[model samples]
Target: MQEYQLALKDKRIAWGMAIAIEPLIGKYSGDSIRPGENAALDWNLPAGVYRAKEVVMELDKLLEAMLVQLGEPVNGDPAVLLDSLQANLAISGQHASLPLGPLALKDKAGAELTSQAVRIGEQLVIWAREINAEKRALTTYGAETLGALEFRSHCYGHPLIPEATRLVWGPLGGPRIMQLYNEYLHQFVLLRDALLPFANWEEVPFEIKEHTEFKGLRFLEPAREIFLTQLLGKKLTHKAIVQYAQSVVNSGLTKTGYGFQYRLGTVLPAGLGESAGTAARYLLKWHPVQTVQTEETRDLAAISFDYEYDDYYAAPRNEAGKGTTVNEDTLPVSREHYDGPSIARLLPNADSDRTTLRFSLEMEGREFTVDLGQLFRGHRFLYRPHGNDNAGDALTKRTSISSHRAIDILSHAGLVTNPDEIHFIPTNGNELVQWALLGKLYPENVVLLDKGDKEELEAAYVSGKGFGTQFLVL
Candidate 1:
């Protein structure tokens, strides 16, 4: 883990986003059906559990519709949404022991969606639809409805900012660099948000026209002088200035032809059904699994844990952090932020350098930043993994992620520890005891399970061939 973290900090390695998909098997079937749909059931009983492919498809469609409503182009890869979705399942032996839905609060439609599964004879099934207090089928935010709501206005596309604009500003008492929707220009807003006290960025409306028109027109005079002086310093003529601006607008940024593509009226993560504090959404899709009517088999329920890690996106603290509320923000954490160093005793090297560290991450398909030193020291991240795809020609892919990238990502994120410490040999069940003995000599040494090692251990415990996956075949 230390080595990987060092690599990330040194820019020797980097990773993209990752996701986990798991099939959920519900316990409700027969007359035990509930009035609302939750993670527990799909409302389509007797068939047992829901299919992962179908659940992903449903979610994809839902997100597409929502984006279209937000005025995003519906065509092209929907990677923006798919890249951030993760698979989650709730499992427990007793029907009532596991956390079930309505995992979230009631939506504005005044309907309660539940997570109830039942057993009919030898089969377990789930409820897929939503039911209201009157037991009437009503439209609500569920697997079926995409949780769609018109909370605010949104638009995608950049405003046309002319190159001739110029103005003056304060603070430095000199001209600053200028651009037509340039990244450098946007830094001022970010700087203000970070340093300005009592910054209510959420209440600050985003207007592409205002951005393009240079709302505070007076500030640009100094910026224009600086831009012209640089051009003249290079012995360039007026023609050069126009050409430079045009070239930048053409290719310096997104293919949308703007260095900073303006996506005004942006919706926060919570507006999209993400639980407060998490950039990703938590959903349980029920799938049917066949079970024999044996004493042990009858009472046993399967459980598994998976996680997706790559980077963390740092949006406004009020939008997706510890203090965000479910009413306004979806990414809320249950505890305070803690991403600093862990106890020296818990690490392999207590004397490792701490001055050089990097904690860049992505959240909800957006760039996010957080204090790693403040996070890992106090918080443990829990995530869901994308189930291995088993389709023809794609079966060779063991996980949804590229194996090498997954290793790199997990290590840098501090979710996996000491990749070299993983052993393929069978355990004698004394690893924990051995760790205590070893700790006597190496106080900083601690046993950490890398992803591969954890998978092997799980497979051994479940007597499975691969990553001990649990999915319904029906």
Candidate 2:
């Protein structure tokens, strides 16, 4: 055995034998070998068999050491090595490089080698199961820890390459192992980039940070650094901003007139400047009011009720005469001395020419009355007579007053002085849009009932905007 080992050490001899045994190797290894190519090869002859001696020898020592490390005992028998190699090859095709024939061991070993090989084979089976479990665990870890996009893009390939598997089961040293390491490191980089936009690194779990398989990657430190730098002093992350937007919508505020008219205050971090508000406007579905037109006409009316009595009550009373001794209470009293005209006389002309005209406007539960004579004196009052339904009372009606006329009337009544400023009822889309636009442009002009922060409210007040009052700030 020693002489054979020394002779095989020569490069020229080893190369010659390797070339000569190629057909036999390919046949047992399941590699594509030409038909009838190995028919000329004779395993029984020493010359034909000796060519594979070096390969068989190397495989024997390697397999024995692997089995011994796994606590399986081995005997120095060529047959045992062949049987164990065959068993491993059956389990995984990558092990097909090991020879299958008994040419090297037929003269030197016996049947007992088979039993010893079975023991080592059992250990190999257990090791293979462990490796498969580890691979599954690593795959799961990658999926859970990495972002969805990154996992799909970078980590979706085969879980374990043959070289990576070999590195785990044995100390297989080569460039392939380094190459696999680089691949894993590159995946870590993608993971870091994927999470940088939204994830808060301080909240990451320790299991992800100290992952057993990827612990050597050292990706967490730099990832955390970059993440913090990008999000420095920011109160809300990208994920948080999305959640806040959803919350606002859910609150039913977006459907309101002043929904998008309010300020964000300190809800956002300083890192995001004024531009963030613009982005938030779209998220909040802000549409400011454009041009407002009145949809309906309201009437202003003045009404008066008149009372009448018979003149017979005023007839001179007959004293002590039996001509029906006047029961003064029984006769109707005269209405001539009354302050107003009699209902009987006024009822016929109440609807048309004789009706006294006036304008009555009510705002905020207070009523203001203006005489039509005075109102139409300096102004060209355009009005249409609105019909009256009540009987026995005189009422004068006017309908569809223009906004300018309304403003002037309000000013004359001392209700409002600014004709340019208008209040938004926000009953329709256009009005709501106008309200939002006014709030955004002239924030001080709109009264924000709830500012969400006392300090912010005070600041707005200090800046000449009424924060809580119905009046405009300026």
TM-score of each: 0.16, 0.17
lDDT of 2 by residue, 258-365 (tens): 111111100111111112111122111211111111123221111221111112133222211111121222221111231211110001113432322233333334
Error of 2 at 255 (Å): 36
After the best TM-score superposition of candidate 1, give how far the Cα of residue 456 lies from its true spot, in angstroms: 15
Candidate 2 local lDDT, residue 341: 11
Model 1 agreement with the true structure over 1-474: per-residue lDDT tens digits: 122111212122222111111322322233112232233221111222222222222223333333333332322233322221111112222222112233332421111111211111011111111101112222333333322221111211212122112111222111211121122122222222111111122122221111222222222334344433443244432222222222211212212110011111111111111111222211111111211112354321212111111122321111111111122121111222323221111111112211112234332243323232222221112212222233222222122211111112222322222212211211122222112111111111122222323443233222211222221000
Clashes of each: 67, 6
Error of 2 at 46 (Å): 56
